[model samples]
Target: MTAYDPIELKRIRWRSRRGLLELDLVLERFFAQRFDSLSPAEIDAYKRILDLPDTDFLDVVNGKADLDDPEEAAIIEILRAV
Candidate 1:
Protein backbone atom coordinates (compact mmCIF):
# COMPACT_ATOMS: atom_id res chain seq x y z
CA MET A 1 0.00 0.00 0.00
CA THR A 2 1.27 3.46 -0.84
CA ALA A 3 1.12 6.33 1.60
CA TYR A 4 -0.85 9.39 0.48
CA ASP A 5 -0.29 13.02 1.26
CA PRO A 6 -3.00 15.65 1.68
CA ILE A 7 -2.75 16.56 -2.02
CA GLU A 8 -3.35 13.01 -3.15
CA LEU A 9 -6.09 12.55 -0.61
CA LYS A 10 -7.76 15.72 -1.84
CA ARG A 11 -7.49 14.65 -5.45
CA ILE A 12 -9.06 11.30 -4.65
CA ARG A 13 -11.68 12.89 -2.44
CA TRP A 14 -12.72 15.45 -5.06
CA ARG A 15 -12.95 12.89 -7.84
CA SER A 16 -14.78 10.11 -6.04
CA ARG A 17 -18.46 9.79 -6.94
CA ARG A 18 -19.39 9.48 -3.30
CA GLY A 19 -17.38 12.57 -2.45
CA LEU A 20 -18.99 14.57 -5.24
CA LEU A 21 -22.65 13.61 -5.10
CA GLU A 22 -22.83 12.76 -1.41
CA LEU A 23 -21.55 16.17 -0.33
CA ASP A 24 -24.09 17.94 -2.52
CA LEU A 25 -26.87 15.62 -1.43
CA VAL A 26 -25.98 16.23 2.19
CA LEU A 27 -26.35 19.96 1.65
CA GLU A 28 -29.66 19.40 -0.07
CA ARG A 29 -30.85 17.35 2.85
CA PHE A 30 -29.62 19.98 5.25
CA PHE A 31 -31.59 22.66 3.42
CA ALA A 32 -34.67 20.50 3.55
CA GLN A 33 -34.10 19.85 7.23
CA ARG A 34 -33.80 23.52 8.09
CA PHE A 35 -36.25 25.16 5.69
CA ASP A 36 -38.72 22.36 5.00
CA SER A 37 -38.32 23.25 1.31
CA LEU A 38 -35.38 23.70 -1.01
CA SER A 39 -34.99 27.18 -2.44
CA PRO A 40 -33.48 28.09 -5.82
CA ALA A 41 -30.94 30.20 -3.96
CA GLU A 42 -29.91 27.23 -1.90
CA ILE A 43 -29.46 25.14 -5.01
CA ASP A 44 -27.26 27.82 -6.51
CA ALA A 45 -25.30 28.02 -3.32
CA TYR A 46 -24.60 24.31 -3.41
CA LYS A 47 -23.46 24.56 -7.00
CA ARG A 48 -21.09 27.34 -6.04
CA ILE A 49 -19.70 25.18 -3.28
CA LEU A 50 -18.99 22.48 -5.85
CA ASP A 51 -17.01 25.01 -7.85
CA LEU A 52 -14.81 26.06 -4.95
CA PRO A 53 -11.13 25.05 -4.84
CA ASP A 54 -10.29 21.66 -3.33
CA THR A 55 -8.28 23.21 -0.50
CA ASP A 56 -11.10 25.62 0.22
CA PHE A 57 -13.46 22.70 0.10
CA LEU A 58 -11.54 21.00 2.89
CA ASP A 59 -11.32 24.21 4.83
CA VAL A 60 -15.06 24.72 4.70
CA VAL A 61 -15.54 21.28 6.20
CA ASN A 62 -12.94 22.06 8.84
CA GLY A 63 -15.02 24.96 10.23
CA LYS A 64 -13.53 27.84 8.25
CA ALA A 65 -16.71 29.37 6.90
CA ASP A 66 -18.80 32.01 8.67
CA LEU A 67 -21.89 30.16 9.89
CA ASP A 68 -24.02 33.30 9.75
CA ASP A 69 -24.42 32.75 6.02
CA PRO A 70 -26.77 29.83 5.56
CA GLU A 71 -25.27 28.77 2.24
CA GLU A 72 -21.70 28.83 3.53
CA ALA A 73 -22.72 27.13 6.76
CA ALA A 74 -24.67 24.46 4.92
CA ILE A 75 -21.75 23.74 2.58
CA ILE A 76 -19.34 23.53 5.50
CA GLU A 77 -21.51 21.14 7.49
CA ILE A 78 -22.25 19.02 4.44
CA LEU A 79 -18.53 18.67 3.73
CA ARG A 80 -17.72 18.01 7.39
CA ALA A 81 -20.28 15.23 7.61
CA VAL A 82 -19.03 13.57 4.46
Candidate 2:
Protein backbone atom coordinates (compact mmCIF):
# COMPACT_ATOMS: atom_id res chain seq x y z
CA MET A 1 0.00 0.00 0.00
CA THR A 2 1.15 3.53 -0.72
CA ALA A 3 1.84 5.76 2.22
CA TYR A 4 0.53 9.30 2.01
CA ASP A 5 2.59 12.25 3.12
CA PRO A 6 1.27 13.69 6.38
CA ILE A 7 1.94 17.25 5.34
CA GLU A 8 0.12 16.83 2.05
CA LEU A 9 -2.83 15.31 3.85
CA LYS A 10 -2.87 18.23 6.24
CA ARG A 11 -2.80 20.64 3.31
CA ILE A 12 -5.69 18.84 1.70
CA ARG A 13 -7.65 18.93 4.93
CA TRP A 14 -7.10 22.66 5.15
CA ARG A 15 -8.29 23.11 1.57
CA SER A 16 -11.41 21.12 2.34
CA ARG A 17 -12.69 23.81 4.64
CA ARG A 18 -15.45 25.65 2.81
CA GLY A 19 -17.45 28.81 3.37
CA LEU A 20 -20.67 26.84 3.82
CA LEU A 21 -20.97 25.17 7.17
CA GLU A 22 -22.66 22.13 5.68
CA LEU A 23 -19.89 21.66 3.13
CA ASP A 24 -17.28 22.15 5.80
CA LEU A 25 -18.74 19.44 7.99
CA VAL A 26 -19.10 16.93 5.21
CA LEU A 27 -15.57 17.47 3.90
CA GLU A 28 -14.01 17.45 7.36
CA ARG A 29 -15.74 14.17 8.12
CA PHE A 30 -14.56 12.63 4.89
CA PHE A 31 -10.98 13.70 5.53
CA ALA A 32 -11.01 12.36 9.06
CA GLN A 33 -12.54 9.05 8.06
CA ARG A 34 -11.17 8.37 4.58
CA PHE A 35 -8.32 10.59 3.46
CA ASP A 36 -5.52 8.28 4.50
CA SER A 37 -6.97 5.31 2.62
CA LEU A 38 -7.51 7.05 -0.69
CA SER A 39 -5.56 6.13 -3.82
CA PRO A 40 -3.39 8.83 -5.40
CA ALA A 41 -5.91 9.24 -8.24
CA GLU A 42 -8.77 9.73 -5.80
CA ILE A 43 -6.73 12.21 -3.80
CA ASP A 44 -6.02 14.14 -6.98
CA ALA A 45 -9.69 14.19 -7.85
CA TYR A 46 -10.58 15.45 -4.39
CA LYS A 47 -8.07 18.25 -4.69
CA ARG A 48 -9.42 19.22 -8.09
CA ILE A 49 -12.94 19.34 -6.69
CA LEU A 50 -11.76 21.56 -3.86
CA ASP A 51 -10.58 24.07 -6.45
CA LEU A 52 -14.10 24.48 -7.74
CA PRO A 53 -16.05 27.61 -6.95
CA ASP A 54 -18.11 27.38 -3.79
CA THR A 55 -21.43 27.45 -5.67
CA ASP A 56 -20.41 24.76 -8.12
CA PHE A 57 -18.85 22.66 -5.42
CA LEU A 58 -21.98 22.87 -3.29
CA ASP A 59 -24.17 22.01 -6.25
CA VAL A 60 -22.09 18.91 -6.93
CA VAL A 61 -22.17 17.92 -3.27
CA ASN A 62 -25.91 18.47 -3.08
CA GLY A 63 -26.51 16.41 -6.26
CA LYS A 64 -27.61 19.39 -8.30
CA ALA A 65 -24.60 19.44 -10.62
CA ASP A 66 -23.19 16.47 -12.46
CA LEU A 67 -19.44 16.16 -12.95
CA ASP A 68 -18.27 15.42 -16.49
CA ASP A 69 -15.36 13.38 -15.22
CA PRO A 70 -16.20 9.96 -13.92
CA GLU A 71 -13.39 10.02 -11.36
CA GLU A 72 -14.56 13.34 -10.00
CA ALA A 73 -18.19 12.18 -9.98
CA ALA A 74 -17.24 9.12 -7.97
CA ILE A 75 -15.33 11.24 -5.48
CA ILE A 76 -18.27 13.62 -5.17
CA GLU A 77 -20.56 10.69 -4.49
CA ILE A 78 -18.28 9.60 -1.68
CA LEU A 79 -18.25 13.14 -0.27
CA ARG A 80 -22.04 13.33 -0.42
CA ALA A 81 -22.36 9.97 1.28
CA VAL A 82 -20.18 11.25 4.12
Candidate 3:
Protein backbone atom coordinates (compact mmCIF):
# COMPACT_ATOMS: atom_id res chain seq x y z
CA MET A 1 0.00 0.00 0.00
CA THR A 2 3.00 2.24 -0.11
CA ALA A 3 3.29 5.02 -2.68
CA TYR A 4 5.80 3.15 -4.76
CA ASP A 5 5.15 -0.18 -6.41
CA PRO A 6 7.29 -1.09 -9.40
CA ILE A 7 4.80 -3.34 -11.12
CA GLU A 8 1.83 -1.05 -10.67
CA LEU A 9 3.92 1.97 -11.63
CA LYS A 10 4.93 0.22 -14.80
CA ARG A 11 1.30 -0.39 -15.65
CA ILE A 12 0.48 3.20 -14.78
CA ARG A 13 3.20 4.44 -17.07
CA TRP A 14 1.78 2.41 -19.91
CA ARG A 15 -1.77 3.47 -19.23
CA SER A 16 -0.83 7.11 -18.98
CA ARG A 17 0.01 7.13 -22.65
CA ARG A 18 -2.91 8.78 -24.42
CA GLY A 19 -3.94 9.23 -28.04
CA LEU A 20 -4.20 12.94 -27.54
CA LEU A 21 -0.92 14.83 -27.76
CA GLU A 22 -1.96 17.28 -25.06
CA LEU A 23 -2.86 14.46 -22.71
CA ASP A 24 0.49 12.86 -23.39
CA LEU A 25 2.29 16.06 -22.52
CA VAL A 26 0.30 16.59 -19.36
CA LEU A 27 0.73 13.04 -18.13
CA GLU A 28 4.44 13.13 -18.96
CA ARG A 29 4.89 16.22 -16.86
CA PHE A 30 2.68 14.78 -14.13
CA PHE A 31 4.75 11.66 -13.84
CA ALA A 32 8.05 13.50 -13.98
CA GLN A 33 7.06 16.01 -11.32
CA ARG A 34 4.69 14.08 -9.05
CA PHE A 35 4.56 10.37 -9.64
CA ASP A 36 7.03 9.47 -6.92
CA SER A 37 5.06 11.40 -4.32
CA LEU A 38 1.64 9.94 -5.12
CA SER A 39 -0.27 8.25 -2.32
CA PRO A 40 -1.77 4.83 -2.99
CA ALA A 41 -5.24 6.32 -3.21
CA GLU A 42 -4.07 9.00 -5.58
CA ILE A 43 -2.47 6.36 -7.74
CA ASP A 44 -5.72 4.40 -7.74
CA ALA A 45 -7.59 7.52 -8.76
CA TYR A 46 -5.14 8.05 -11.59
CA LYS A 47 -5.65 4.48 -12.75
CA ARG A 48 -9.36 5.13 -13.04
CA ILE A 49 -8.69 8.40 -14.78
CA LEU A 50 -6.60 6.52 -17.31
CA ASP A 51 -9.61 4.36 -18.09
CA LEU A 52 -11.35 7.37 -19.60
CA PRO A 53 -11.29 7.89 -23.39
CA ASP A 54 -8.81 10.46 -24.67
CA THR A 55 -11.33 13.26 -25.22
CA ASP A 56 -13.13 12.66 -21.95
CA PHE A 57 -9.82 12.47 -20.17
CA LEU A 58 -8.70 15.74 -21.67
CA ASP A 59 -11.99 17.39 -20.82
CA VAL A 60 -11.70 16.31 -17.21
CA VAL A 61 -8.13 17.49 -16.99
CA ASN A 62 -9.14 20.79 -18.51
CA GLY A 63 -11.96 21.25 -15.98
CA LYS A 64 -14.74 20.89 -18.51
CA ALA A 65 -16.30 17.80 -16.92
CA ASP A 66 -17.61 16.97 -13.49
CA LEU A 67 -16.39 14.07 -11.41
CA ASP A 68 -18.37 12.92 -8.37
CA ASP A 69 -15.38 11.08 -6.97
CA PRO A 70 -13.32 13.54 -4.98
CA GLU A 71 -10.26 11.36 -5.28
CA GLU A 72 -10.38 11.49 -9.08
CA ALA A 73 -11.15 15.19 -8.91
CA ALA A 74 -8.08 15.72 -6.78
CA ILE A 75 -5.95 13.84 -9.28
CA ILE A 76 -7.34 15.97 -12.11
CA GLU A 77 -6.33 19.04 -10.14
CA ILE A 78 -2.81 17.73 -9.96
CA LEU A 79 -2.83 17.02 -13.69
CA ARG A 80 -4.04 20.54 -14.35
CA ALA A 81 -1.17 21.94 -12.34
CA VAL A 82 1.30 20.01 -14.47
TM-score of each: 0.41, 0.89, 0.92
Worst 10 residues of 1 by lDDT: 9-18
Candidates in descending TM-score order:
3, 2, 1
> What is the TM-score of candidate 1?
0.41
Residue-level lDDT of model 3, residues 1-82, one tens digit each, is 3747789889889988889999999999998899888898888888988898899989988889968899999988898898
Give the count of colliding residue pairs in each prediction. Answer: 0, 0, 0
Q: For model 2, what is the alpha-carbon lDDT of residue 82?
A: 82
RMSD of 3: 1.6
lDDT of 3 at 27: 90
Pairs of residues at least 3 apart in sequence or in different chains that clash in candidate 2: none
Clashes (candidate 2): 0
Q: Which is the leading candidate under lDDT? A: 3
Checking candidate 3 for backbone clashes, the offending pairs are none
Better of 2 and 3 by TM-score: 3
Best of the two (1, 2) by TM-score: 2
Which of the predicted structures, 2 or 3, would earn the higher lDDT when compared with the native? Answer: 3
Candidate 1 vs 2: which has more lDDT: 2
| Candidate that scores best on TM-score | 3
Model 2 agreement with the true structure over 1-82: per-residue lDDT tens digits: 3466768877988888888988888887886787677898898888888899988999999999889999999999898888
